[model samples]
Each structure stands twice: as structure tokens, then as C-alpha cells.
Target: MSLDRHILSFLRALVSSRERKVATAGVVIGILYLLNWSQRKTSAKISLGHRSKKSNKGTVDLEFFKRIIELIKIVVPSWRSLEMFNLVLLSALLIARTLLSISISSVNGRIVKAIVTRDFNLFMKRIIQLAMFAIPASMVNSGLDYLNHKLAIQFRAKMAYYLNQKYLTGLIYYQMSNLDNRIANPDQRFTQDIDKWASCLSNLYSNITKPCLDIFLFSRKLSDLVGAEGPIFIIGWYFLSGIIIKFITPPFGLLTAQEQQNEGLYRACQSDLVNHSEEIAFYRGNDWEKRRINNTLDKIVKHINDILTKRFFMGTFDSMLVKYGATMTSYGVLGLPVFGPNREKYFARIGNDPSSITRDYIRNSSLLINLAKAIGRLVVSYKDLQSLAGYTTLIHEAKVVLEDLANGKYQRTMMEGAVYDQKSRGTYIIADYIKFENVPVVSPNGDLLIERLSFTIKPGMHTFIQGPNGCGKSSLFRILGELWPLFSGTVYKPPMEQLFYIPQRPYLPHGSLREQIIYPHSREQMEKLGYNDEYLENLMRIVRLEDIIEKRGGFEQVEDWNDTLSGGQKQKVAMCRLLYHKPKFAILDECTSAVSMDVEGSIYQHYKDNGITLITVSHRESLLKYHNHILKFDGEGGWNFYTILPDS
Candidate 1:
């Protein structure tokens, strides 16, 4: 129920809200011009890339907010003659507007008639008009496009705002730290997934409006051309075309989706190649990486080849339909009308103007030819767009996955007014993140790290979990902190705000030294946290980082701290942050391996003095003396968590 509600909430956020429904109104405007593709006239317009006003474009840029005002002015009863004036203006524009729709059958007849009579001059004129018809159509299309675009942006921005709010709303992030297995990478969902969603939404909004416009406009044009006969012929042809399109469309859309997946996989491999570049170089694994990359490329190539083969065959068939459909329909439909029979035959006193017969013949024949080509091309283009939209649905699906992740997560309630204590079965607990029952974690790929385990921790407690490399020390820390979920277990934890976990290689966010320490806090928060200039300076001095503090501008924020700080400095910076946060509990995952033992011992002593519980991961016996509890993991598989006994 929560997940369903989350999805509903996400969709609601995407479609509209009270404050921004005005922008979503643009979607309604786009539908107005979406039907017809080709027009006979051209006008000034703004391209999406530039969005600047142009003299040649015919479409009006109806800013969403501006349109509301214009609408209000028209409908108001007290607005003297405003509505009347708008109607007059609209009517004038409609009457002045030149519409040109050339039917496929009519153009075919004209070409046949022209060819039969060898009247090349007349044929050329019709062809020229047909060529220029798209300009006006495009302008009207562009106007509608602008409206749809505004709506898409509004929807995207609104959804992004809401999704972010929900994802970052509470201690969901804290509880989720323990349940990583339950959730995928949230970052990927936020960045890549959101982009796909926006793009898909834009395309979907355009398509819904476009097809309805096409059906209405095309039906109208056909009806006007041949009266009863035209509508029947056009509708019948469309039905037949749709059936054929259904069969051909699926393969291309499927192929496109496969291509996307293959591409993403290839990119992921490349990323791994880049991330471990130093390792590969030092171990002479260049050849190995190269071979792996080549293998991936080869696999992708085969899939693409299969897709291309199907695409080419389908393209050939579609082209055949369009090319011959234009040629045959133009001759039979238009030529038969103009040059069917002599209308002035057996007329004795009729005005014998040969030019009259010729003019009528030319007009009827030529217009049919132009209309035929224009309408045929439009149908083909529409088919291509439809197929592409179908394929993009997968992209939309991927986007929704992220949206779901962002909204759906487990909520943790901290035990209020409660403190933790160390236990015999604890993996490592000098402080909070005490585990009562921990089941082994079995990944989908069948990798097992830890078995059923249990433990506890308390404030002001100092403990250490020691094991050989990769015996799951860090993994245990993660599970205890509730960042990595045990396949099955319940973990009791203090309020998240009261605890902090420090990694082996602490991450430096893109910010200054002070910002790094008080990370994710705003500029105003620095002062609120009792972090004055003198305090910052003294902290740096204590960490032996006075030179960097002085050099990098005190409290004046560096843009990128990761590149600026060295390994030792970053660790010390993390410690400084630990001191600053003054959390009751802290987890150190080999956090001081880079620093000297003297420095490490002093930091531990400082934490003890401050009455802060310290959980340290280190190989140094010198450090273990400070920790009263020893949770030792045997290198093979078994482990023991017990109080340290001082013995000879």
C-alpha cells in the first residue's frame, strides 16, 4: 500500500500541482495543431535550441503565465468588448490563413495526366507548390511545440523537487544504510533515471496530441477533396496501413531497447576499466582489460547487426509502399478526373474557348499530384515517429524504477531515551549500532559473508573487531551500522543523529575544510554550530593542519576539497569533523591506518576524554589496549566477540 501510494504520489507530482498547473495547461494547447504535418505556407519561428523570436516564424510564443492573463481578459464579463475583440481577431486570422492540403490520389492523377499530354510546364508548377507546403505546416507545429515544451519542463521540475523532498525527507537515509541490499543505487536513479523520465514525458505528451490532430485533419482534407468518396478511401487506407504497421513496428522498438541495454553494459565495463586503471597498469593487466573490452564490443556488434538487418528489410518495404502508392494513386485519382472525358463535346453554341478546357484540366490535375506526395510523406514520417516512441517506453520504464526507489524506503524509529551496551556475541561494538540478531547475507549471486550473529553496544564504550584482511570486518561494521542489510535480522540502534561512521578512506566532498568538517551544512550553520574562526583555526592546529588552513583561505570555502587534501589530511579532516559533531558514538573502519600510531592514540584518548564511545578497526596492539571489548573474526569463517582479558 505504501509503494502504491508512493507511485501515485510520484505521478501526481509529475502531472501537476496547485502552484504550477498553469504551465501544464500548455499540453492542452499543443493538441490544437498536432494533427496535420505538411502545410503549403511558411512563417517565422523559434528553434528549440535558440528559442529566440524570429521574423520568419508564424507561431506565437504563448508563455504559460501570459496565456492565463489573455484568457482571463477574454472571459471577463466586465472587460468591455475584450472577448468580442478577441473573437474578431481570431476570426480574421482564421479567414486570412491560407490552407493547402494535397491528396495523394489527386497528385498521382495530375502527374499521369501531365505525362500523358507532355505538358511539363504545368506539372512543374504543381511539384513546386508541393515542395513549399511544409513550411507553413511546420510553423503552426512549432507554436504547438513551444506550448508542450513548457508543460514538460514544469512537470519535470516539479517532480524532481518532490522526489528529492521525499528521498531526503527524514532518517530514511539512516535506516536504509542497514538495508542497502533492499535498494539499488539511489544516485543512478536520481540522475540518469530522472533524465529519461523527463525526455519520455515530453515525447509522450507530444504523441498523444499529434495522432488525434492527424486523424482529424487528414479526415477533413480527404473529405473536402472527394466528398463522400474521399473520406471512405482515406479511412479505408489508414485502417489497412495501421494493421501493417503493427507487425513491422514491434521489431524495431524491441531492437532499439536491446541496443540501449547493451550500450549501458558496455559503458559500465569501460567505467570499471577506467576506475582500476592504476591496478591494471602496475600488474600489466592492460592486455587483459583490452581483451575484455574487445569481447564486450564483439558481443554488442552481433546484436546490433541483427537489429540492422531487420531494420533494413522493413525500411525497404515501407519505401516501396510510399513510392508506388504516390505514383499509382496520382495517375488514377487525379488524371481520371481532368482527362477522363471531353466535357465540351457535342455542344453547338457553347463558348468555344479551348483555353477554358485547358485551364480547368491543369488546375484539377496539378493540385491532385501535389496533394498526393505531401500526404504520403506525412504518413511515412508519422510511422517512423510512432516506432521510435514505442521503443522509448523502455527508457520510461527505467526512469520509473528510480522514481520508485527514491520514494520507497524503510523508515527507522530510534529507541528514545535508551542507551546500548557491549555484548559477548557482538562483532565489534564500543558504541551504538548494536545488533541483537544477525542472519547470514546471501546475495542473489550466492555470495555469503556473515552467518547468524548477535551483539550489543553502549555509549562511552570502546571496542575493536579484528580479523585477517577481508574476513568481513568492514562488512560487519556496515551491518551493525545498518548500512548493509543482513539477509535476516533485527538491529537496535540509537537515534541516527547520535552516531557517526568513519570509513577507511574517508570521502571528501567538493567543499572547503570547514565545509568538509561540517559537511552538508549550509554557510549559516557554521556559526550556529559554534564554529567560529578561532575555533576552526585551533582545530586545524591540533590536527597539525594549520599550514593548509592558512593557505586555503580560512572559512572562505574551497570548491573541490578531494583534490586539494592529501590522504593524511583527509583522515585528519575526518577526525576533526568527528570532534566537531560530538556524536555519542563513532565507528572507525581502519580510519587511522595512514596516520602515525602516536597521532592515532592521541585521537582515541581525546574521544575517551570527551565521553564519546569509540569503535576502532586497526591491526596495532597499541590501539587495542584502549578498546575494552575484542570481537575477533577467525580468518577462515568463525569468530568470537568477548571482553578483553588482561593476561600475561
Candidate 2:
């Protein structure tokens, strides 16, 4: 027999006699028990797979819930907070909406009964009641949507605030980017992934919570109208169908995570192109970039197509069982009270009246339909939940890494044959003068550039450092600036505020020219220091950039200074910034490499006249006249420090 026919035959046999009814109930209970056991076993396996720290991307198991709970704490911090109030109000609204639905269903049956019996007055009364309900019904639905989106925005805001705090706190951003290898694109996680996670969380809350409330309320009302067995059979049928669908469902969570990863890669590729457009154009690497971009796109397309195929088949099966099959089951349940052998029991209340029978059937059928819809939504939420798990995994991984970095813990994939010196940790101290006592210059990736080095720059001592390329010149500055971790030996330096560093390629922020000159400072701070725009203008003249202020529309005008200024102009602007800060010591790492020779000489003389000691890194012999001492690296893990002869 076909499935529907078999189901009908079984339903008929179930209510035929007391003995058959008992036997059928036992069989159903046993089958449900077995299915429940099997489902638990499957869930256990899924949980085990997802709990694996190395491969825990897409699985929805206990670990997924754990991550969700942890993130929830961040989004909704306190019970008395606004988020909690909104949640409670939203829950109340959902409950009110469900109750309104039940009332509407009853009114619908009454209207149908009045029409069949030709009672115009009764029909009109029910119609007016429904019209009155329309206002609150609309309000409830609109409120749900408004509150859901508001909560999502709040969640996103809270999460972003917390993450930005961690990201910008004390060189964590630099350490995360340079010292960690776990998160490939933290930028994507911070912006896109967090937004998605917040939205999914808000929608999932309503989707799952409302359905659960519906199931409970609808099942109770259904039992009252159609006897206990009627609701039990329907609920049991849906339960079995849920188990079947769970087993056949695809790993959508894993697929979603993979899709997001590919998207991040593609975005990163485009960012790289933008950042290096000039270099790429000079090399004519357009074809190479296109191939790489297309490769990433292909991966995303393939992943989405795979998900679509699985969803198609899964949706087909889901509709067959949850929708049409439920309709068939409703017919059987409806007949149990009116047409079964126990019809005599309901005859007095229903009273052999066709109108009464029709009314009960309509009302009972509406309840069953609503119940089926609620259960169907619960089943469908499984897929959404899986997608949420994917987002949760991504966000949780990033949070873990940030926390690890904050705790001074890091993990990096070291270069081949690079030995990390675990026992030789360097010490840092604050002093009036700068000194490095047997400090090793080590790169972030465990490359030891200078095995041991000693140097000192006391007050009035202008020291010059020269090294071949990759001979730890930049590495030393990174260590001094606390961008890289100190690895070995004792290093003493003035407070960070007393030391200023100017790199070869200056970083011009997207702001007014004034902000560029006093970067790491605000316009208000510049004013409080007894300086004004005229003082800034004088600093500009000293760096031979006197015309740039008027050329770029004054100091208050904002532009992309990096693109607007020429290379030589950019270096001059950097020099102007150094002159503005006027720190006791300045580390000039090729900062004047792009300036004219005369301009560079005058810049060094200006620093000498101001009594700002300089630690200059340059290969230009012309700068040797301004420095009293030299620290030279030979590129073979060696260095020397000595006085520079006045003539040399």
C-alpha cells in the first residue's frame, strides 16, 4: 500500500477496539523511544566532532551552544539592562500574538457556523469582533519587527564596542596581526561577521521562542477540543518526522563557515590590490590578480551551489512530511471524535446536527493547522541554527585570539629551522638615558638578526646607526617602540613619550593637514600647549613645506594626504611632525631619505640647534657630520659602537 493509505489503515485500526487501541499505543511509544535513543546517539557523535579544537568550524553540538552562551553574555550583559527589558517585552508580545491567533481561529469557526445556519446577526457580530482585533494584531506584528531590529542594532553596537576596546588596547592590534596566525582576516570578523552574527541572533530568538510557545499553547487547546489521543498522535507524528529530517540534513554550518572564509579571502585580495595598485600596475600584474580573484570567487560559488543542492532536496522532503503529511494526519484525528465507534459519546454535545459537526470540524482543523505550522517552523529553525553556529564559531575564534594576545600569549607558525629561545627573555626598564646591554635583535618570526648588542645614548649624545638592509635596523626600533616583544637582555630607555620615531614612509591619516602635523594629538591639545596655527606654519617652513599649507587649502582642509603629497613632500611633512613634537630623543629611520640634500642638511642642523638628540639610521655619509657617535651593523650578526672623528 502507498504511505497515505497505510497511515489511514493504521489510524482506523487504532480506534476500532480497546485491545487494538492499547496495542497501537504500546507500539507507538516503543518506536518513539527507539527514535529518541538513536537521535541522542547521533547528537553525541556530532558533539564529539564539533568539540575538536582543530576542526571545530561548522558542527552544531554542545560546543556550539557553549559558544553562543558566551557571546550572549557580551551582547546582553546584565539582567536589568535595556536588552533584557526588550527581551521580556518581546516575549510578552509574542505570547499576546499567539493568544490573538487562537481567538481569531475560534471566531472564524463561529462565523462559518452562523453562515451555514443563516444567522445574519451572529455572522455580523463575529465579523465586527475580527475587525476590532485587526488593530492590535497589526500593532503586535509591527512591534515584533521594530523590537527585533532595535535589539539587533544594540547587540551589534555592544559587541563592536567591546571588541574595539580589545583591538586598540596597548599594541594588541599589532601583536594580533604580526604575532598570531590563527585569524586570517580579523577586519572581516570585526565588521561583517559581527553584524551577521548579531542579526542572526536576534531573528533566531524570535523564530525559535515563538514557535515553542505556539506548540505548547496550541497543543493544550487542541487536546481540549479533540480528546487527549488526538493531540498526542499529531505531536508524535511530527516528532518522528523531525528525527528523519535531522538525520538527512546537510552540514550547513560547516558550509556557511567555508563560504565566509572564501569571502574574506576575496575581500583581502581586493584590499591588497588597492593598497599596492601602483606597484601592481608597474609590474603589469592585472592578469595575475584577476586569476587569483577569480579563483577565490570560484570557491565561494562552488560552496553556495553545494549548499543550494542540499537545501533543495532537504526542503522537498521537509514539505512532504511536515506539510502534506500533517494535513492527512489532521483528517484522521478529526474523525476520531465524530466518526469513530465512540461517536455516541460526542452525540449529545454535537447532537447529530450537521452545523454542529461542521463547526467542530472547522475549529478543530484550524487548531491542527496552526499546530502543524508551529512545528514546521521549529524544524526549519534547525537550518538557521546551524548557520548561526557557523557565525558563532568564527566570532568565538577571534575573541579567543584577542584574549590570548591580551594575556601575552601568542601562537605563530615559525619559519623552517627557526629556533625560539624560550629561556632568554629580555628585560625592559625606564631610565633617563637609552641603553641596550647585551640585547639580542630578534624578528617576530624568531629570526635572530643581531645575536648580542650594547649601546648607550646619554643626554647630549647624538648617536647614528647604520646597517645593511635586513640587518635589524627596523627590528631594533620595533622592539624599542614595544611593537615586537622583547626577547633577551636588558634594555633601558626613556619613557615612550620622551622618544619619537619617524619611519621612511610616513603614515598620513585621513584628516586635515594640521592633524597630520600633530598626529597622535588633537587640535585641542595643540592649542593647550600654547601653540597656534602660526607656530605650526613656522614648523612647516623649517621642513621646507611652507607652501603645502596654502597649496592643500590650509591646515583645516582634509584630504587623502598620502595620495595628495609627493614622496618628497610626504617625508617633509613627517619631519614637520617630528619638529612639532620636539621630544628629547628622536629615532629618524631614513625619515629624510626623500628630501633634497640641502634640505636634509638643514633639517639635521635644525634638530641640533633645538637640543633634540637624534638616533639617525642612514647610509648617507653627509649625515655623519651631525652625529658624535656611530653604531654600525655588518649584517653578520655583529655590530660596533665608537666615536665619530670630527673630520670623518
Model 2 worst lDDT run, 10 consecutive residues: 44-53
Top candidate (TM-score): 2
lDDT by residue (tens digit), candidate 1, 1-648: 344575588678866766357655754543432221111001111111142222111121233224323322322334344434433443332222223333433444555556666779978976765566557656545555554455445444644565566556543454433433332334444455445445544554345434444445545554444344543444455446545544443234334444555665667678878877768889999888889888889879987886565555546546555555445554444433333333224122225544433443454445443344444544455444434433334333333333444554332332343222111122332334555566453322234555655666666457787889877777766555545434455666666768888887887877666788776667588788667868867766666677886688676767677667778888998888887777888888888878888888788888888888777888778888788887787866677878774321
Could you give candidate 2's per-residue lDDT for residues 1-648 as a string of tens digits? 455676698778767868886777867985775565456445645654644446667678999999999999999999999999999999999999899989888888888899899999999999999899999999999999999999999989989999999999998998888878788888998999999989999999999999899989988998887778888888888898899888777677877887888899999999999999999999999999999989988988886886786677677668878998888888889987766556787888777888878888888888888888888898878989989999999989889999998888888766677656423468899998899998888877788888888988887788889889999988988988878778878889999989999988999999999999999999899999999999999999998899988877898999998889999999999999989998889999988888889999999899988979989999789898899998889999989999875421
Q: In the order shown, what is each candidate's alpha-carbon RMSD?
A: 18.2, 5.9
Worst 10 residues of 1 by lDDT: 37-46
Residue 6, candidate 2: Cα error in Å is: 13
What TM-score fits each model?
0.66, 0.89
* lDDT (CA) per prediction: 0.55, 0.86
**Candidate 2 lDDT (Cα, 0 to 1):** 0.86
